[model samples]
Target: MKEYVLLLFLALCSAKPFSRPSYMTLKNMMLEDMEDSDDDDDDDDDDNTLFPTRTPANPFFPFDMLPTCPFGCQCYSRVVHCSDLGLTSVPSNIPLDTRMVDLQNNKIKEIKENDFKGLTSLYGLILNNNKLTKIHPKAFLTTKKLRRLYLSHNQLSEIPLNLPKSLAELRIHDNKVKKIHKNTFKGMDALHVLEMSANPLDNNGIETGAFEGMTVFHIRIAEAKLTSIPKELPSTLLELHLDYNKISNVEQEDFKRYKDLQRLGLGNNRITDIENGSLSSLPRIREIHLENNKLKKIPSGLQELKYLQIIFLHSNSITKVGVNDFCPAVPKMKKSLYSAISLFNNPVKYWEVQPATFRCILSRMSVQLGNFRK
Candidate 1:
C-alpha cells in the first residue's frame, strides 16, 4: 500500500514541480549537496517523495546554520525572504517559482542578465543595501510581473537602461549615481513612484524624459546634489520633492508645466528671491515646504493657490511681509483652504500681518479659530 502511494507521488512530481522543497528535505539538502547528484538515480530517494526518514544522528537543531547561498539568489517562497543578510556572492540553483524575493542588505557584486531567469512568478525583488557595482543588460529582462524593486543604499554608479516595464514602485535611494540615461526607464509604461533620494546626481540629475512612463503621484529627487528642478518630468506628478537640493533659483517658467503638482518640497536650499509669478500657475499646490533657506521677498500672486493647505517657511532668512506670501489664494476661495502655517522662527520679530499668517495656518481647522491681533 505504501509503495503504491510512493509511486503515485513520484509520478505527480515528474508531471509538475513540487510546490516547494519539503521542510525535512530542505533541512537535509541545504546542509549538504544531495548524494543523488550522481549517474544513476536512486529509486529509494524517489519513493520517499516528500522526505526520507533520517536516523537521529544528533538532536534536531534550528535551521539557521545551513550553508549560505551566494548573492543574486532566488528563494522560491515566502519562507525564504532575504533580509539584512551579509552575503557576498550569488547563489546557484535558486528555486524557480519564487513569489517574493528580498535580496535586501546583501553584498551582491553584480546583476547579470537573466539573473532572475527561473523566478518566473517573482512579485517583489528587494535589492536594498547591497554593494552592487553594476547591473548587467537585461538583468531583470524577463521579470515582467514585478511590482516593486528596491535598490536603495547601494554603490550603483550608473543608471539602469531599461527597468522592467511592469514595475510600479522603484526606490534607488542613496547611491553614487550622477546621471540617468535618456532611455533609462524607456519602455516602462506603468511605473508610478520613483524615489531617488540622497544620490550625488551632480548637476544633470535626470535627463529629459528620464521618467518617461511614470504618471503617478510623486517623484522625489531630494538630498541629491542638484541645483534646480528637472524641467522635463511627467505631466501628471502630484507631489514633487526637490528639497534639500542645491536649488538657489526658481522662476515661474521652471514650474509652468507642473500644473498638476500638489505637494512641493523646495525647502532647505538657497532660494531667496521669488519672482512675482513664480508660483502663480500652481493652483493645485496644497503643502509647500520652503523652509530653512534664504528668502527676502515672496510673490503676492502666490495667493492664487486655492488649494494651498500647509506652508512651512521655517529657518529661512525671510525679512519681507505680505498676506499673499504666506496664504496664496484660489478663485472663489473658501474660508476652509489654508490649514497650518509654521513660520515660527523667522527673522522679523514684530508682525503687523501676523494674524493673516495665523489665518492661513488655521485654514484647514474645522473648529472656530481664536483671533490674534496683528
Candidate 2:
C-alpha cells in the first residue's frame, strides 16, 4: 500500500497540474454564455428583464450629449448668460436650441447680420448696457420667434430696422436714438410695450405714421426732449409716460385720441396749465402723475373721472384744495374712491384746506400734504 501511494504521488507531481483558463479565453467563454443567455431570454417579456435592451455609448450619460457651452459664459437648459464679460461681439457658438441670450453689460459695438443666425427657437435677447451703435438691418431676420428684446443703455441712434414682427416688448431706453422713421415699427402687430425713454427724441423727430402699424399699449418716452405729446401716437395706448420732458401744458386735444389710456404720466415736466376739458376724454384713466411741475391749480376735469383712483400733484404751485377738486358732491357717481392724493411741497396751507376736501379718498393717510419749503 505504501509503494502504491508513493507511485500515485510521483505520478500526480509529474503530470501537468490543473490551471485556470487565460483571461482572453475566460472572457470569450463569458461572452458566449451571455449570447446564449440573451438568445434564451429573447422569448421572455422584455419589460420584465433585469437589464436594459442596449447599453448607452457614453458612460457619463445624458449631459455628454448636450451642445457645448460658449467659453466664459454660463449655459443651462435653454438659457445662456453671457453678461458682464466685456465681449466685443455676440458669441458665435450659441446653441441652436437656446431660448434666451443675456449679453448685457458687454462692450459689443455692432450686431452683424449673421450674429444671431440659426437661433430660431430664441425668444428673448437682452443687449442692455452695451456699447451697441449699429445693428445690421437683417440682423434679426432669422430670429423671427423672438418676443422680448432689451436694448437699453446703448449708443443706438435709431430703432433697428427689420425687427422681429413677433416682438411683444422692446426696451430701448437711455440710448442715443433721436428719430423714429415711419416704417420703423411697420408690420410689428404683436408689439405691445415700448420703452424709449431718456433719448433725444422730439416731436419732429418722429415721422408721420411712425407708430401706425403697431398696436402698442404701453409707451414710455420720458426724459426726452418732447415739448408736446406726439399726435402720431397709436390710439390703442393704455399707458403713456412722457415724464421729465419739456411739455408746457396739456391741451384739450392732447389726450383726445388716447381715450383708452388708463395710466398717464406727465410728471417732472414744465407744465403750468392744463386745459379745462383736457382730461375729460380719458374716462377710463385710473392714475395721473403730474408731480414736480409748475401747475398753478388742480386740473379742471378730475371730478368727472369715475374711475380715477390716484392723483399725484405734489411739488406744484397750487395754493388751494377745493372741496370739489377731487370728488363730486354726489359721491355715488364715482365708481372708485381715490387711493392716493399727493400735494406736499406746494404753497397750499394745510389748515385752511377743509377736511371735506379729501372726503372721496379711501384714507386720510393716503392724502399727503403740508411739507412746503421755499
Candidate 3:
C-alpha cells in the first residue's frame, strides 16, 4: 500500500517536462562548424570559398531573462538583478540574446573557445579586476559585432591583437606587457579609442607597423617602458601619452609627420631637450605635458601650435627657464583656457622666470586603454 502511494507521488511531482537541451550539443555543433571553416579554407582561395562561414553572423538578442548584465557578485532575475551565486563559468542560464556581459569580479581564469558560441548580439564585455591570467587568441573571434572591450585590472600580458575588424574601443590598463606585436592593430580601420597604461615595455616588442592603420581619438600609453615613439603614427591621432617612459629626446623629426595631433604627454621620462621644428607638424596640438623630466629648455617650433592651450612643464630638474622659447597667447575670456605655463613643482631661477615647472597629468578618471596590468 505504501509503495503504490510513493509511485503516485513521484509521477505527480515529475509530470511537467520542459525542453532544456544540454549546452554540450550546442558546444559541439559550434566546434564542428569551426573545424569545417578551417578545412574549407586550408587551401581554397578566397574567391573559391563563396559560402559564408558558419560562425554566428546575425545575433538576435532575446531579453526575456538575459538582459541584466552579470557581475561576479550576484544574480538577477531577468527583470530584477540580485547577484551571481558562485558562478565558475559564464552563466548557462542566461538567455541567448544577452547584449552586455560584465564578468568583473569572477574568479574565471580560462575562457574556452565555445564560451560565447551562440550569443551574437553582445556589444560590451567588461572583465576588469578579475583574476584571469590566460586568454585564448580566438576567445573573442566569435564576437564579430562587439564594440567596447574592457579587460583592465587582470593579468593580461599579451595585447589582444587581430581583433574583429568592427572593433571601436579597447581598454587594458595595468598589465605586464613586455612587448607589443606590429600586426596587433593591423586592419583595424574603424578603431578609435585605445588605452595602455602602466605597462613595462621592451624595445623590440612593439612591431614597427604595430598601429599601421587605425584612426583614433586618443592613444594613452602613460607609465610605460617606451624608449621612443614609433615614427609611423597616424596623423589623425588626436591625443597621445608618452609619460613615465625612457625617452631622452624629442627631435623635430619626431613631430614632423604629426599634422593633426592635438595633445601630447612626455612626463616622467629622461628627456632633456625638445629639438626645434619638432613641433612643426603638430598643428592642432593645444595641450602638452613636459612634466617630471630633465628638461632645461623648451622647443621653439611650439610657437607654430597656434591652438596651444595648457602646457604642463612641472616637476623637472631645471634651475632656470629659457628666456626665449615662445610668447604666451592672450588668455581668452572663454573657459577654453589656452594658457601656456607650468605651475608648482619646479625651482624657478628668478622672480620673472616662466616655463619654470610643470605638473602631473594623472587623469585617473580618463578611461585607460592599454595592457591589463593587475
RMSD of 3: 14.9
lDDT of 3 by residue, 1-374 (tens): 99999999999998987875446655565566557666767856672443455444223323331234444333332121212344456655444565667777666676666776666766777777766677777777778887888888778778865577777898888877777777788788888988878777755677788778778778888777778775676767888887888998887788776777888988789988777677767777788888778876555665445677667766665555543344334323222334446634555544554321211122322211122122
| Reference-based lDDT, residue 352, model 3 | 54
Please say which candidate is ahead in TM-score: 1 or 2: 2
Among these predicted structures, which one has the highest TM-score?
2
CA lDDT of each prediction against the hidden true structure: 0.70, 0.91, 0.66
TM-score for each candidate, following the candidate numbering: 0.73, 0.83, 0.69
Model 3, which residues run further than 4 Å from truth? 1-87, 321-324, 328-337, 353-374
lDDT of 2: 0.91
Task: For candidate 2, write residues 283-366 as lDDT tens digits.
Answer: 999999999999999999899999999999999999988989999889898999999999999999889998888888888788
